[model samples]
Target: MNGKFIAIEGLEGAGKTNAIKQVGKILQEQGVHKIVFTREPGGTPLAEALRTLVKYGIDDEVITHEAELLMLYAARVQVLENVIKPAVTQGAWVVTDRYDLSSQAYQGGGRGIDSGLLNTLRDTILGNFYPDLTLYMDVAPSIGLKRVRSRTSGELDRIEVEPLAFFERIRSRYQILAEKDDRIITLDASQELSEVTSALRVQLIKWLKNKGY
Candidate 1:
């Protein structure tokens, strides 16, 4: 693709929404006008339906780890083929709220799924497709959950309702993956909102400069 692809990743309540807005502002300042924003598991009609199923599940029916992971990939492939690919092919920068890495951390680490199985699924389903850059907002599980609780009083989704230990594991996995990958930037999201945004702006700008944006 001629255009760039950026993916934002984080645990729940890591201020990704604000980070995305900051990214947009920075890109605009850098004279990037053709920007397309998307979210994983819900970027298209079919994908949205699958997102709902994966998030809420059927009434009183248990969703196995494997089933959940498969549902995510189904939704993901739909977004990839229908929305992201077309946008990027047309030279529009594609910014996504989440992507394949979410599954690696949440399913592989939190759900205790096998890494080999996860890697195989990713390789088979997505092949070499991946974000040009990934911004991982790092936050402590307790603090992140506190933010979530403060922001919304409604019922939590399936993944959001996961225990603290689960999130801790996911965070650990994210750190591990980010450390190993040059494309992924681990941002400290435990700071205040303003501080987090400031840090994000600096990192994004640095990356943009490196890419000759």
Candidate 2:
């Protein structure tokens, strides 16, 4: 893999949609223009169908935890086989809105799934495959929910509608992972937009230089 995979991960309303653009600009300056951007759950046709099934709260039947976990991995595998891996093989950079870490935070930490089981599933699906750089945007759950509410007049998605406590647990897991992993950098996303953009550019540039890009 000459091309790099950069994943931007965080809870809902953590400004990930905009953060990708910043990362893209920094990558362009580093002469990486063959960039492909992908979002979790909907990067391909089959993945989009699974995303709808996993995200929309339809017919009021609770989606079992086991079902949710399987669907997420199913969508992710589709993206990898159909989109991410192919692009990376062709020497194109990939920036993603979310990736494997979401499951670690949501299913494992938030839903209280056994970490051992999660790791087993992850290894089965992904093995050693992972991002070259991962930016975990850290935002307070209260602030994140408020941002989501103010931006939307309609109902929230199934996971996005989870209570504050749920997101708090997810955030805690993200913090722990970012602190422990050198590749995962935690960014304070509660700052002003310009400040956040500048911070992302600076951090990404530093990492790129360190990698001999």
Candidate 3:
């Protein structure tokens, strides 16, 4: 049987780490042994470099939104071709922390980039490529940012330091996109960790069974 590509997406502090762990556990329980884990913009060596640039940026240099978006796609393409595609083709489930949806939410909505341009870029770059299942952990920007700030002692990354309005826009786009896509499942991430985990497990199991996993 062929493998599947699963992606988890949300704003920072949406508990993506927990969601990823839960997905792995559920997949194992469902008898999926060959799983390839990945995190967007850092799955490969080249992509890792780009991830650093995107996250921290260069010394004393202003990074434009257009450049940021391009760099993200560059990193995404590298991982998609080098890691994700090969793993799934070889019958290993590919689980990624983020995917194209991040671009749509962060770059398109948060940065207020033109939707036509974003759509054109996505279609031109990726064609029909997309995750088989996308799990979106939805949380309010204020709540999510508070959770993020509480955990990290170090300074926030470039994107992480964006205003609450930025994250709010991203969250809005995420909800809009998730609602439109059948393959994307939205989980309320404002709940306690245990509750989120329970919800994730239930949803994942149902999806897995539906897919005949």
Candidate 4:
């Protein structure tokens, strides 16, 4: 694809929605007006259905770990094929809230699934496709959950109600992945909103310039 693809990744309550806004603002200021905003598991109609099933299964219908993992990728490829690939192919920047990294953290780390198997599934579905840049918003689970509680008024989705240990593992995996990938940068989401935005803006501007955008 000719256009850049940037993925914003983090655990729940990491302010990814706001981060996407900052990304849009940064690109707009750089004279890049054609941009598409998307999130994993819900960017298209079918994907949205999968998203609902993943987040909230119908009345006690158990969502097994295997099913959750598969559904996530299923929705992901749908969005990638119908939305992300086309947007980037048409020279429009794509800004996504989450992608494969999430599955790695949530399923592989948090749920104790093996990374090797997840890798196989990822390769089978996505092949060599990946975002050019991924910004991981790092925050302590306790602090993040507090923010989440305030925002959601203590109401949480199924996954959001997972134990604190789940998020800890997810964050640990995120840190490891960020350390290994040059294209992924870890941002401290615990900072004030303005500071977080400034840091994100600077990182994106530098990366975009490096890419000759």
Give Cα distance to truth, residue 109, candidate 3, Å.
0.7
Instruction: Give the better candidate number (3 or 4) by lDDT.
Output: 3
The candidate maximizing lDDT is 3
Cα lDDT of model 2 by residue, 1-213, tens digit: 568899999988899988999899888988989999999977999998999999894799999988899899999999988999999999999999999999999998899988998899889998898999999999999988899999998878888888899999999999998899998988999998899888998899899989898
Expressed as tens digits, the lDDT of each residue in 1-213 for candidate 3 is 678999999999999999999899899998998999999878999999999999999998999999999999999989999999889999999999999999999999999999998898889888899999999999999999999999999999999899999999999999999999999999999999999999999999999889777
What does candidate 4's lDDT look like per residue over 1-213, in tens digits? 489899999988788999999999889999999999999878999999999999988899888899999999999999999999999999999999899999999999899888888999999999999999999999999989888888895458899899999999999999999999999988999999999998998888899888788
TM-score, cand. 2 vs. native: 0.97
Error of 4 at 126 (Å): 0.2
Task: Give per-residue CA lDDT, model 1, range 111-200, as digits (tens).
Answer: 999999999999998899999999999999999999998888788898888889999999999999999999999899999999999999
The clash numbers for all candidates, in the given order, read: 0, 0, 0, 0
Q: Root-mean-square deviation of each candidate, in angstroms? A: 0.9, 1.0, 0.7, 1.0
TM-score, prediction 4: 0.97
Task: Point out the higher-scoring one by lDDT: 1 or 3.
Answer: 3
The order of the candidates by lDDT, greatest first, is 3, 1, 4, 2
Q: Where is model 3 poorest over a 10-residue stretch in terms of lDDT? A: 204-213
TM-score of each: 0.98, 0.97, 0.98, 0.97
Question: Candidate 3: which pairs clash?
Answer: none
Worst 10 residues of 1 by lDDT: 151-160
- Cα lDDT, all candidates: 0.93, 0.91, 0.94, 0.92
